[model samples]
Target: MYQKSLVELAADLQKGAYSSEELTRACLQRIHTHDERLNSFVTVTETQALTAAQAADAAIKAGTAGPLTGIPFAHKDIFCTNGVKTSCGSRMLDNFIAPYDATVTQKLLAAGAVMVGKTNMDEFAMGSSNETSFYGPVRNPWDETTVPGGSSGGSAAAVAARLVPVSTGTDTGGSIRQPAALCGVTGLKPTYGRVSRYGMIAFASSLDQGGPFARSAEDAAVLLGAMAGFDARDSTSVDRPVDDYVAQLNQPLQGLKIGLPKEYFGAGLDTAVGDAIAVAIEEFRKLGATVTEITLPNTHLSVPAYYVVAPAECSSNLSRFDGVRFGHRAANAQDLQDLYTRSRGEGFGSEVKRRILVGTYALSAGYYDAYYLKAQQVRHLIRDDFLQAFAQVDVIMGPTAPSVAFKLGEKADDPVSMYLSDIYTISVNLAGLPAISIPAGFSNGLPIGLQVIGNYFAEARLLNIGHRYQQVSDWHTRSPQGFE
Candidate 1:
């Protein structure tokens, strides 16, 4: 029952093979059994999930349930669920319980999806590996010592371990795709503003967009359909009509032109992972995609530019966490300065502080133009490079990360090395395009992911491409051995 995709589970639900209560129970049981090792969930809403499952069961009996009725899924802890602890993997928010549901959460609940739990993430979505998380790092199910790539690490780990069929994740810079790559799952980062951000705890607001993680592209499409749409609450939410994502799953990719960015394939990418991506591209060629080498000239500037831009935005967005408003406050304080200093100094993790410092420096008066404004100009160039490449190709493909999962503490000492893990993914956020990462194959026993990047609002095409690849391969279907 746990092995089935969300689409299959939904079909079985409609066919009366199992009740929502039973499905929810199965997921809860799995979490109870396996989450001790993976540490994927921050808070398991067992009572709320059971109650919602019962309601879904009632709706099913009444013949009014939607397509996703009774299907179980989890949300990354960044999303604010009314009365649930919406910790963004930070000590500051450790005791915070939101009074409102994120727009995405509201829509999914309305579509009858059951909430299994809230998954773990990096502190304020700052790091590549899950090590920055205040709850502790999430272990890759593939190998217990290996890290599940992060901010969305818990979401990918949960889905990959089959604790849940699909889960929600937000990507500021590769938070969704990179973790999906390491955990061997499917994750999508929809076009910026396509999915409403209301009530999703802000982290680099302009770049943070939430989407779904699932075992297959079809399941992702189903989840995306329910999660996306215009939300007046989120001023940036595009008012365009939402498409039936699942309806477009069967679209073929014949004659599609896939661009392989020259810079992505050059030095620094691990050979084993590169080989796996090459094979995946070859398979696409066999399926009738025309492959061409393209150049995203500004690729090298992406990481530096992202560091400057993302942190600058993060510094501003995270400022709202001052003890007076909400979240953790110091137990003892002589005055406002003491309160702010003690609260923040104790609340944030090392990496979070490091970024806050970097961001504060870049956004400061004298450094503003040199760092922030310059980074913004470079960001424009990066986007322009993609625009140029897309003019001649239907989609771009690359390895989601340089390599597969690394040991838990492997890069923790070096922040720059950790930042580089997002080299291939940050550009997509910088460009504000749609991208998806699917388990392509494995290298040295760890999962590797193939990144499918589409033009603006090209989620349908990316999903179709991913669906085609998944239809021909079983890599996405393979689970971590012990978990099954």
Candidate 2:
């Protein structure tokens, strides 16, 4: 049951091949038996999951079920779940049970999906590796010593390990796509404002977008269909009608125009990963798609610009979590100011503190124009680069990460090197465009992801492209050895 794709599982449930309760039990059992090895889950709601599964079974019997009914999936810890510990992988919120559901949580629940657990992630979504998580790192199922990528690493690792067929993740700076590449899964980061961000703990409010992780593009499409829509409460959410992501999954790619950026294939990309991407391109060509070379000139400035912009937003959004309100509070203090100092000092991890400090400094009055304003200017250039490329091509293709998963501590001490892990992805967020990462191939047994970027609100087109490639490829279907 765990081996089946989400689409397959949904069909099985609808056909009465297996009850939702039975599948949910199998998933829970797998988590208990193997998750300690991966540290993927921060919380497992066995009682609630079983109860939800029973409700789903009743819905199906009453012939009132949706596509995701009875499906068991995990939520990234960053999304608040009512009555569940929505610890954003930070000690500050370790004991904070959410009083309400995030918009993503509400939508999934309405779709009849059962939440099995909340997956671990980087503390405050600040780090490139899962090592910054307060609960400890989430191990890559493909290679335990290597990172699964962050801040959505746990969600990616859980799906890769088959602990769940599908799960939710938030990508602020390649969190969903990078980990998906390392874990050999299909992940999508929808256009900004395409998915509601309400109730999702903010990292970089502008860049943080909730998405899905699954074994195939088809599964991602199904999840996206349920997860996306206009939300009146979320001001950032676009007031646009949602596309039928699943309905377009099988659209032909015969005339697809794929643009391969010269920068993406240049220095820094792993040789094996580049070669894998080359082969994947040929596969698309065989499917009758035309490939062309393109340039995103401002791509070189993406990393630096992202650091400044993302941190600036993070600093502002995280200000609400002071000692006075909910979350962690200092045990005792000499005064109110001291309480604020101690609470934040003791609550946030080193990486989180580093980002917050940098953010604060960038947004400081005297330095605002020099750093924050300039970064925003560079961000515009990056967005323009993508706009120009999109004008010439239907979609842009590249390696999701410059390399395969690195050893867990390889870049932990070197923050610059860690930031570069998202070099290929940050530009999309800057442009607020839709993108998808699918398994391209592996490099020395580790997986590589082929990123597909489309114009804003082109999620359906992006998923259709991914689904077409998946039809001819088996990379997404392969599982980590022990888990299989």
**What is the TM-score of candidate 1?**
0.99
lDDT tens digits by residue: candidate 1, 1-484 = 9999887888888889999999999999999999999999999999999999999999999999887899999999999999999999999999999989999999999999999899999998888889999999999999989999998999999999999999999999999999999999999999999999999988898799999999999999989989999999999999998887877887877899999999999899999999999999999999999999999999999999999999899888888877998899998799999999889988899998888899999999899999999999999999999999999999999999999999999999999999999999999999999999999999877999999999989898888889989999999989988886
Backbone clashes under 3 angstroms, per model: 0, 0
- Look at candidate 2 and give me any clashing residue pairs: none
Kindly state the number of residue pairs that clash in model 1: 0
Residue range with the least summed lDDT across 10 consecutive positions in model 1? 244-253
Candidate 2, residues 47-163: lDDT per residue as tens digits?
999999999999999999999999999999999999999999999998899999999999999899999999999998888789999999999999999999998999999999999
How close is every model to the real structure, measured as TM-score? Answer: 0.99, 0.99
Candidate 1 error regions (>4 Å): none
